[model samples]
Target: MTAEKANNLLEQIARSKKEGRLPPVHDWHPPFCGDIDMVIKADGSWHYMGSPIGRERMVRLFSTVLRRDDDDYFLVTPVEKVGITVEDVPFVVTAVQVRDVEGAQVLEFTTSVGDTVVASAENPMRVELDPQTQEPRPYILIRDRLEARIHRNVFYELVEMAKPTLIDGVEWFGVESAGEFFRIAPVS
Candidate 1:
């Protein structure tokens, strides 16, 4: 997304928030509004490069497990769901972009399967679950150009934490340890 478009989106989100309204539902993830922030590291987790700013913003971050036909894709649920899974996932593709580095831009979709643990209880048939087996699938594609990095922070954070390093460009990760790196505000 371009800076202009992203700024417009932020304006729309701010308006919705001021009126106590929720974000409009889109093809990608279900309409979600919250305080979203991301810290980008410039040199492989060396330091913070920059971050995005918004109020009661729309969170568009997602993870895709795999791809099929034209629409037979799987993604994760919105960030606000009770339990994250492929079934809890939503489908959306608001914008696309290509970074300054080589290679095509990676699209992040939400899936139903995420950090969840299921244990089987039995006297002699106890079984443990594997976490990697539950990772969301990915749909790698090629698209020309890229969208405004408006939600770049959101997408950056998602890919940083979920997807692996593909290029030597900017990378994202959650603010778990860098608590001081992120700042959020309540929705109106």
Candidate 2:
């Protein structure tokens, strides 16, 4: 997609968000695959074409091709990955579900659909919400417990202290770990 076209599509999404319309999901066109694209939620769980599945099976939805970096654990979809069309603009995305194994929290990636195998640098692809959540859930969860483990075991190693000493008087910082934080922050 050209930059001009991509910009127009983004503008449409902005308008939709303002109008309180649900973000569009990429419906795969022919030559891509059979299954539909997925959407992510505020809690980092996946809704499979309107059906919600637990984090474990969601992770298994992908067939392990090879391990990528910690940020992106490279894997192939068990089913056909599809090309998603939003506001008439199309992008490829695959459905993915990841779990912490030790924690109930999960990480979901609706990756760009394509057969071009590559390592996950930062985020290998862009994830889109069904327009509605995209408005409210603006903050994307890139690094999570599952991704941390993949980086440690397959890509790179990350060392974290069991406890982090905070600087007193600091208003807030990002969560130190998944289980240790709350999704909905208190309004003060």
For residue 164, model 1's alpha carbon misses the true position, in angstroms, by 39
Q: What is the lDDT of candidate 1?
A: 0.25
After superposition on all C-alphas, the RMSD of every candidate to the true structure, in Å, is 20.3, 16.7
Off by over 4 Å in 1: 24-128, 133-188
lDDT string, candidate 2, 63-132, tens digits: 1121223233222222223332122111222333444546544334343322222223333322223376
Ten-residue stretch with the least lDDT total in model 1: 117-126
lDDT of each: 0.25, 0.30
Where does model 2 exceed 4 Å of error? 1-31, 34-37, 63-80, 84-188
TM-score of 2: 0.23
- Per-prediction TM-score, please? 0.21, 0.23
